[model samples]
Target chain A: MRKNNLKGWLYLLPAMLFLGAFMVYPLIDVFVYSFEEGYNFASQTYFDIGFYNFSYVLHDTYFLQALKNTFLMVVITVPVSTGIALLISVGLSAVKPLRNLFQTIYFLPYVTNTLAVGLVFMILFKKTAYSDGLVNLLIHWFGGASVDFIEGPYWAKMFVMCFYIIWVVMPFKILLLTSAIASVDRNYYNAARVDGTSAFRIFRKITLPMISPTIFYLVITGFIGAFKEYSDAVALFGTDLNAAGMNTIVGYVYDMLYGDSGGYPSYASAAAIILFVIVLTITCINLLISRKLTRGFS
Target chain B: MNTSSQTNYEQISKTSARQKRAVHVLVYTGLALWAVMVLFPFYWMLLTSVKSYSAYNGERFPRFYTLSPTLQNYADAFTTVPLGRYLLNTLIFTAATTALMMLVIILAAFAFARLKFKGRNAVFTLFLSLMMIPNELVVITNFATITNLSLRNTFTGLILPSVTSVFYIYLLKENFAQVPDTLYYAAKVDGTSDLKYLFKVMAPICKPTLVTIGILKIIECWNAYVWPRLITDDENYYLVSNGIQEIRENGFGRENIPAMMAAVVVISVPLLALFLLFRDKIMTGVSRSGTKG
Candidate 1:
């Protein structure tokens, strides 16, 4: 037993060290650093600012807008993406032939470079001087006026980003939910059918109840993911993450820390901490709510 | 009376069969539509990559298909940017990070799964809780640490922070735990050392999960845009994703769009091939990770 314990410790040492240095240390350092005001990255100089940094970030128009945009993304994306995924998985579960082919097609989006595809969408949605782009061409084919997608109003940009998130995230959710739907006992369906249960009723009661846990899982994780939206925004709008009026919190923080306009690492740290707190609070709330749903299932 | 009842049963069966066929048709149509929607952007990307330069940015309306297709854009992609070099860097980073992650995760997972250790459960629980903390929160301090260590622009800076994945460790641990204890002791009775047992018996038993994690990690590295962008200042160290982003941002003219698209296409092709070949494993791996979370 003693020898086994020693061996285990030896095995765990590297991982502990790595996580300690990278994760635990950074977490504490950032929390501490978030309190400093006007801290210079080069000079490594700072004075204790208490909650002033948080207050400043809260009051700042850009940061507040970013906070709102991030929340909007989470609110709009989680349900829309998860809902679409649920519907698709239901359709997919009914089919047997060419199922894998369709899945592979859908999953290609998840595997493709998000930034690269965001760039493609950027170009596809752009309205050129000579002609509306591909999307517009299709609209024109139907005798409808072209809609400005990228350079349009704030809500239009938000719509585009939300559309991108939904499209990209649908595959994973569908994959999960399809498997979830598949794993539910076949006998239940047989029993329901024997009683002459209508198809929609069978799905609504049996299928939905059985797959409620998976849906809950998707919603919670999807909510957390939306808050961290950064690269897609960058890919679509370049460094000009601001379009119309929307900017993601992560993108705003990135500009502060790494953008060419010089960085205030300390302020960025505070913003990140704020983002962290928001994520934590939301996760806790989700867990609290999900406990009720999962308990009923159990 | 019996013959009439039999005819009624036959009529009901025939109607139900027709209904089933109708249901199948609806399912297929819906899936097909979504699949087309999913594939349309990729098709457009490929189409745009091959369009003649004039068609790409001409005064004429955007054409869906070009009368003439050319590889000039692909050629320009290579010429204008060190795409091949960026690809090589990304490949190196992917391989290196995946190898390091596997080595660390395997050993740690084996320890957590099989070994009798003090505070083992406590340590494992701590790691699990760490997973809840979004990585974005730590990027600030991590950036500072890397800069302080003077690791910026180096592959070590890119690989080191991400070398040990807590999630992969947990997945492998779950896989390792499923291995029966009797086999492990039997190997011990046969004079197998712990490391030998792990390599010879444990690893093979968990081969599928390991492969899944390996592929996912590779894809993660391939799609990695943020950390690589932050760490590497020099173009030589730029990963393919960020490299294309930089080109799209910095390239001066509207005419460069095709070349940029070509670059995106080149970077994306290998991943598409990988996905096609290992579709089942990738999907299973993802779903497994999701449920575990």
Candidate 2:
């Protein structure tokens, strides 16, 4: 028993070292920095600080806007994408030759850089009608005027990002759910058919119950991704657009790092900590829900 | 009853034939249209990459898709910037990280799935639970930590922070558990060492899953824009994604859509190649994980 235990530790040592150097050290540093003011945006110096940074960022108007945007993004994206992906997965499962092709297409977006992909969408959705952009061209052909997508305050910008997020992230949720979806025994469906039950009824009675755990997984993952993601705002419109959009807390951190920043990065650290806490709480809630749902996932 | 049965059979057969045709068309239309959407931007990129500056700048639709297409963008792309260096840097970082990750993740997964260790569950659970934390959140202090170490803008600073992957560990563990224990028992009975057994027995069984993870790691590392951007400031450390973004911002003209599109095509082609190569492994892994193969 002692030898076996020793062997196990030997096996685990490499992984532990890797995590210790990277994950644990960085985490500790973040906590440490949260209590201090970073110095010299140009020279990039670190200095001492009290709780003033936290208090300032807490009271800032931008903090509130970031909170609102982050939560709003989560509230919209999680259930919407998970539900739609499930529908698309189910719809495609009915086809044979096209199944692999559809899966590849669905998944291709996930592999591409989200920011680069977002740029493509920006080009497609430019304000002008029929001048090289896709959506505008379509609108012009339909005798409708082009709409300025990014110029609208906050919501339109948020919605544009959300639209792309849903389109892009759908593949991941579908991929996982497809895993759970395939596990449902075909015999149950055969039996249901013998009893004259319709496909919809069989799906409700058989499919939904089995895949609840996967659905729950998607719920939490989608929410977590939504909350922390918006670094792409910098990629899309650079610092100026992100500051105006108010769509993500992460973007706020980037803005504070590079923008006027008011000489207080300790506040950004505080914001990061709070975002971490909220996301962690959501994760805990998800764990509980997953445990409950997965009882029947068997 | 007999006369009504014949009528019902006739009606049902006709309806079924029409429905089958409709389903075929639906399948074709839906799949084909999305496929087009998926490939059109790519098509545009491929075409634009060959267009000269004058032709690309022209507002009128270039009379033909391939009218006197040139390879100058490809040439200019390499010559105008340090594209080769960035590509080399990305390749090196990706290769190193993937190798280390595979070794670390595979062993840990084996220990968790196969061996009996003290605090085994505890360690694995700690790793799994932390999977929820956005990797971006860690960058705040990671920047500070690297700065303190005087490793900023270095490849070590960029790649070291991401070497630990809970997701890959979890995935490997899940797949490893499915490998039959009888293999282990048989190997032990044959007086083979645990290392040999792992290499000779479990490794082959888990190859597809590992390939899937490898493909995933390549994709993530290749597209890792934010992390690399945050970690490295020097042009020497630029990954393809970040390199492309910088090109857009400071390198190219906004009206130079063709050149911009060319860059997209170039960045994407390797990924496309890798995906095509591993397409079979991807499906197999999915099927084993209960998704379609």
Candidate 3:
């Protein structure tokens, strides 16, 4: 038994060493740095330890803007994308012929590179000396005036951001929900049909309840993923996200550490901790609600 | 009276069949519309990629199809920037990271799943909790650590932080546990070493899960942006994720839209092909991860 223990530790040693250096230590280092006011990266020293870094980060307008953007992204993208995905999935479930083809087409975006996709989106929406972009052209065709979705009004940019996010994220949600809807017992639907229930009522009473767990799961994960969005904005708006006013919370942390106004580890750490807390709180609340709901059902 | 009731039943059946057909039409129409919406950007990308730059810019309105498609932009995508080099770098990063991660995770999973070590469950729990720590928090300090080590612009720096994934370890452990214990006892009776038994028995049994993990990890490493972006400012080490951005900002300015689209098309094709090829495995892996949450 003792020899077995030794062998186990030996096998685990490589992973443990890497995790300790990268994951575990970084977390502790971030916590310590967040509280260390006026820490200098060059000298590796700090004047004092306090909550001043947190206060400074919270008070900063750029950080606040980033907070607002991230919150809006989470609020807007999660429900809208999930609902759209659910509709698509339910539609997908009902159809028989050509189902695999449609599923494959929908899942394409999931595998595409984010930056590459962002560039495609940029060209599609961006206005230039050449012409109004494709989207604007579509608007004009529909007898609506052109709106510059990129490099335009704040609302327009936000609209484009939300649309792009929904476009990129919905594929995975659709894939999941399609499978979830498929896994639902056909007997429930048959019984509902025998009772002469309307389609909407059958969906409401049987389909929705059957798939609530998956929906809850998607919502929670969506919130977490949206909160950590940085590269998506970087891809769309460029690396200088603050100038574009579309910076996310993760982007803020990167900017604090390495952007034009960078070299402030303390501030970055503080902002990171704030993000951590927000994500953790939301996840816990969702978990509690899911537990209650599942318990009620079962 | 019986004939009248039979006629009434036939009428009800015909009406219900008509309703079902209408529902099917509605469903198919809706799915097709959404599929077009999902696919339009890719279509647009391919269309723009083949159009001549002057032709792309000269249009008063963007056309859905190009009459005289040229592969010139594809050539320029490789030449104008070192997109070829970026692709090579990405290939190297993905290969190394995935290979290293598989080794680390497989061993750790083996230890957790089969070994009777003291405090094994406790250690496993600690590893699982590591997943709760938001990656952004860890990334900040990792940047500092890599810089402090002066390992910037090296593959080692880019690959080190990504070589282990707790989630993959947990997944593989669950898979490994499903292999029956009788096999191990039989192997022991044959005087097989634990390492040999693992390689000979457990690994073959869990090949599907292993393949899924490998493919997913490759996709992840291919798409990784933030860490590589942070650790390597030198253009030599840029992955395709950041390479595409560099091409936009510097190599080809905003004026060269078609060339930019060409670059994007080249970068997106590999993974799209991979997903199409392994659609089932990828779908099952992703769905499994989601539900486990």
Candidate 4:
């Protein structure tokens, strides 16, 4: 038995090696490269301790916009999607025959390739002076003027962007919350019923608390996922071949590396390192906070 | 709990039947509306994909069966985009990466679940916390790593960074914990190696979870766009999603939107079909993942 147990450890070694080569190695290299003066793809010469790389990214206007946009995206998306999905999922708990079917429908968007979804939106949203898309079609139905959704930073752009993310995200949340809502003992509901408590009250006191842990779980992950998304920027917004300044932080990193490095991408690497630190730090904080909040239940 | 709840719940249920009926109606209405919103875009994409240029330019929605619908867009899509190459690349990437991730997750999950080593909770917590870090930073550093490794345009480079799925480990580890240490003891008694026991015993018990994670990894790998685009500058290395973008970029002027949509529809259909085929497993996988989301 001991021999076999050791064998299991050995089997796991190959995977560990791959992780070391790919994940651990690169992660360390990011720091090393970031601290270096400059890296030329042509020569691969990395020399100098230019904190200037980090300083430049820190001072860049577009980088700040990307950071702002990315943060706003996470803050707005996580709670909103989780809250709405929780509502829909709670509603779904009592309905059996329709539950799985509807849940599947909601989850469809989540599973679909975001690339196609983004492209589809671009075509659907295409509105010039004379043309109309789906939203415009609806507005016309209401006897209203057609509006270009992606152009102006009106309620329309925010609305479309939010709507797109919410659609993609809601399914995952609904599916997750459905299980959490189901986890609550039916006895609690019965007890409340025996006490003549209203359905809403039972939900507030029992259902909400029971599902708080799951809610926290979705929020942090959702924030991370939504924040990193640059598909909409690249696919839906502009035509720089890589969707230029609708730049999310990740998009900005991409722009720096692939777009115009001027033969030296060390600055982008520095920016990337800072981003890694930020994400690592923020994620750790989020986990600690979630743990603290749901210590008892989790 | 069931007995008392059954009695109290029955009383409340009997009294609230009418109210619950109203609630049911409202709930269904809300769900139906949401379902439409969630569902309509995909439907619209399909509908628009099939609509001919005349119909697309002319009508809001196709009304009759008499109108000519051609697979021309599908044809143009395939021809216009290196969709064949993209699909092949995506399939290969997803399959390879999924295989790799599943192997790592199953093993690491076992280690986390069964092995008694230091930093167990702390390490698990680190991986779980890794969940909260958006891919933005990782991807940027990943690009830098790729450039350094000189793996800039390779398949392995594309697949390497993404194969580390922390959440999958959490789910599998949680499932693995439920296997009752009795099994591990039995395996030990039989003198099976830890690796063999994992594959031979724990892996079988965790099969459902494994399958679920496998499907997810495949779907996720297939859907990968941002990193692939960043890492690979050429269309030769493009995955299906980014390839679609390449198609759009190169064929922008002459290709009609419907035809382009036809290309998208083609790109997406296989995955959608896969989703339908494994709908139950996928839902449960997603649901279970969500339980701790």
TM-score, ranked from best to worst: 3, 1, 4, 2
| DockQ value of candidate 2 | 0.35
lDDT string, candidate 3, B61-102, tens digits: 888898899999999999888999999999999999999999
Off by over 4 Å in 4: A1-9, A153-155, A238-244, A260-264, A276-298, B1-12, B59-66, B103-135, B148-150, B163-202, B252-255, B290-293
Better of 1 and 4 by TM-score: 1
iRMSD per model? 2.4, 4.4, 2.4, 3.9
Give the clash count for each candidate: 0, 2, 0, 9
Please report the candidate that would top lDDT against the real structure.
3
TM-scores vs. true structure, each candidate: 0.94, 0.84, 0.96, 0.86
Lowest summed lDDT across 10 adjacent residues in model 1 chain B is found at B248-257
lDDT of 2 by residue, B191-272 (tens): 9988888778887998878888887777778878766766677888898877877777777665665666667777777877
lDDT against the true structure, per candidate, is: 0.84, 0.71, 0.89, 0.74
Off by over 4 Å in 3: A292-298, B1-15, B291-293
lDDT tens digits, residue span A167-283, model 4: 777878888788889889987876678888877888878898888887877876786677666776666664352233456776777777676543446666676777767766777
Candidate 4, A207: how far from true, in Å?
1.6
* Candidate 1 residue-wise lDDT, B1-293, digit = tens: 37875576556657678899988988888888998889888888899899877777783467767778899989988887788898999999999999999999999999999998998999999999988766777888888889989999999999999898899999999989999999999998999999999999999989999999999999889999878877777888899888887788675255477888898899999999999889889988888886211
What TM value does the first chain of each candidate achieve? 0.94, 0.84, 0.97, 0.88
Residue B227, model 4: lDDT of 79
lDDT of 3 at B214: 95
Local error of candidate 4 at residue B91 (angstroms): 1.5
Instruction: Choose the strongest candidate by TM-score.
Output: 3
Q: Rank the candidates by lDDT, best first.
A: 3, 1, 4, 2
